[model samples]
Target: MQTAAALRHAQRILVITGAGLSADSGLPTYRGVGGLYNGTTVDGLPIEMALSGPMLRRDPALCWKYIAELGKACLGAQPNAAHYAIAQLQRIKPDCWVLTQNVDGYHRAAGSPPERLIEIHGQLSPLFCQSCGAVDPQLSEHLQRPLPPLCKKCQGILRPPVVLFQEMLPERAMETLHEEMAKGFDAVLTIGTTASFPYIHEPVLRARVAGGFTAEINPQRTDHSAAMDVFLGCRALEVMELLISHI
Candidate 1:
């Protein structure tokens, strides 16, 4: 296995991370055993319905509940080594563009700037009013004690800025991702999340479609793991630290 060095040294790198990246940080993602109600009581409300655009339009309180849960869960969470590795890689390769499907703000907290990071799923930092269309941003401190951020103007319901189910990925961001893949990036790294699985796996799929080498960092054997030229199976943080040392 050629260490992540070669990939990290690429002229143009496009690194896409998914939910798995945050899993090590004590965040609960689907396919994990731990979560609200031990991931069991969510029968009536699948993730999509609870976080989709239409649902937000129908009931803002649901979005509030979702964000509230996330806020609560994030209280004890900290950025793991994998996230720092991404930042380190970014510093090594300034031209690289990093994209992530996670809504959690760990990457940002880990020092990845907004300019270099593309959060495809949106974030929970801001709250928007579905009625008056008012928007406000909340730093981590605000979330500790309160309901989800509310619209100051109309007091209308407020929801987090995530790509809910039935919502399309931000068009501008997707275009940028496609352009990089089409231009034939030197290396494409998929990290920690199901970006190696069915969802958020487009970049890996693109690499395969273009005959480009692929990299995967995940603990499980995702469907496309076999296709990757390099597979680092473990916590993303550990894999990243190893890869960074080599780089």
Candidate 2:
């Protein structure tokens, strides 16, 4: 209720989301690509190593094996009510922005404006050639054919724009985030993430430091929960619609 009131009154809002939010859509919520794996892959490599940028360069087939699985999982699921609720909230609040770690692109699928949505981790579709920089639109088709999809233009290996392990976050997304953070927010509501990383928690701290409201929604208390003005211990799917309705 407090978070809803703060969001309703606040003109500038930042809604931070993570993997847990998309899990409501039946997507797995583990490390790397919603993480269909836990300890190691069939190749006997750690999931992180198998999904890393270096691995992609060294053995694209191995890397893409996992990538394809994640891609299939994402393509199989639809955005749930919470995603739609956030999209609706964005429509209601012109200044509302979504900063998400998810690469599933569910926010975009749920009708959140691309300009207002920041996918810090990048996305899974529109695979591009690392060699010729050619855009490949046949991700689903390629998935059905090969281990490492190749570019039609140059026969180069195609990969998603997503930020793999050991890869840097997208520069443009980071720039946009910093620009908005400089402008500051009146309310910051973090959903579904543990706020374990500095980037994840920085916005919340910024809002609080600027004398604004900050809250979090998660089924369990997280590293940043104690810092929030109000912590809603519930799934985003369970409360996001209620929160948006109040707005």
Best by TM-score: 2
TM-score for candidate 2, please give it: 0.96
Error of 1 at 10 (Å): 1.5
Specify the highest-lDDT model's number: 2
Residue-by-residue lDDT tens digits, candidate 1, 63-103: 55665666667656888888888888888887777898888
Q: How many residue pairs clash in all the candidates, one count each?
A: 5, 0
Q: Candidate 1: deviation at residue 140, Å?
A: 5.4
Worst 10 residues of 2 by lDDT: 29-38
What's model 1's lDDT at 201?
62
